[model samples]
Target: MRTRVWDKMIHLPVKYFDEVKTGEMSSRLANDTTQVKNLIANSIPQAFTSILLLVGSIVFML
Candidate 1:
């Protein structure tokens, strides 16, 4: 998704580029990807690990 956004920005017309600043595009791409990376790297794996541990403990206790 971030790459797609970058490709779109890269192919945009000169008028669009003139109006938009480089820092804004760079920040947008960086932040959006960072947010996605944090979620995938942190939240998703944590949730899966918690679920696995809970299930394993329950089965072992039974």
Candidate 2:
């Protein structure tokens, strides 16, 4: 699901985009990819770890 969404975003037609005309495509590509990287690099692992910890604690408590 995420991969499909990201593939669509990455393959978006840049030839006629307003941002491309305005010469902002570089920034858009760089910043958008960076934001996505931050989520995948940081948030996903943290979320997975937190969920695992919570489940482990609950099971231990029981």
Candidate 3:
């Protein structure tokens, strides 16, 4: 994903880089990737567990 993001940024217009600082762009890339990693690592399993619990509860109730 970081590679993809870097590829996209590489193709962007020079005008964009002129306006945004390189440090800021790198920081944003790092932060965004970390957030995505955290969401996948933490949120996905929790959601799957919740769904399984709900299905189990409904099955037992019926």
Candidate 4:
């Protein structure tokens, strides 16, 4: 979640800030949250059902 990412951003060491800029962090936070949401909502369930469907179809055919 973005909240968790924001909490992590808040806890970063000062040395980390020396190399990475605020804009880059912001963009990454946005991207990370999007990836997480997609994985949870779409990717995992789709994979699970696709495997079940494939097995069911093969079993029914046999």
Candidate 5:
């Protein structure tokens, strides 16, 4: 994901680089990728487990 982001950034016109600060871009790259990694690594599995537990409880209750 970081590589893809970097590739996209590299392809952008020089005008964009001139307009945006390097620090801001770096922060955006780091923060956005981290959020995505967290969602995939932590949130998705937790959500799946929660759903499975919910279904199991419902079945056992019935």
Candidate 6:
């Protein structure tokens, strides 16, 4: 990704998947991917569930 950003400045050809899974790759993906998964799994469901309950309450009052 960094190389792609600076591709114009450097003349070396770039290729992906060269370091698909290694120490740096695992470190980068482990924390970020877990956080992303938690956000989607827990926060999103809780938000939608709360909204549904709120709408149900309003409809019941009406």
Task: Compute the lDDT of residue 27 as modeled in candidate 5.
Answer: 89
Error of 2 at 42 (Å): 0.5
- In model 4, the Cα lDDT at residue 10 comes to 87
Better of 1 and 3 by lDDT: 3
Q: lDDT of model 2 at residue 49?
A: 100
What is the model-wide C-alpha lDDT for candidate 1?
0.90
Candidate 3: tens digits of C-alpha lDDT, residues 1-62: 88888899999999999999989999878999889989999999999999999999999999
RMSD vs true structure, all candidates: 3.4, 4.9, 1.4, 1.2, 1.3, 8.4
Instruction: Indicate the worst ten consecutive residues by lDDT in candidate 1.
Output: 1-10
On lDDT, the leading prediction is 5
Ranking by TM-score: 4, 5, 3, 2, 1, 6
Reference-based TM-score, model 5: 0.84
Candidate 1 Cα RMSD (Å): 3.4
Model 4 clash pairs?
none
Q: Write the residue-wise lDDT of candidate 6 on 10-61 in tens digits.
A: 4523443363435655555566566877899999999999999999999999
Compute each candidate's TM-score over C-alphas: 0.58, 0.63, 0.81, 0.84, 0.84, 0.55
Model 6 ranges off by over 4 Å: 1-27
Q: How much lDDT does each candidate structure score?
A: 0.90, 0.73, 0.93, 0.92, 0.96, 0.65
TM-score of candidate 2 to 2 decimals: 0.63
Clashing pairs in 1: none
What is the Cα-based lDDT of residue 57 in candidate 6?
A: 100
lDDT of 1 by residue, 1-62 (tens): 78788888889899987998889878989998889989999999999999999999999999
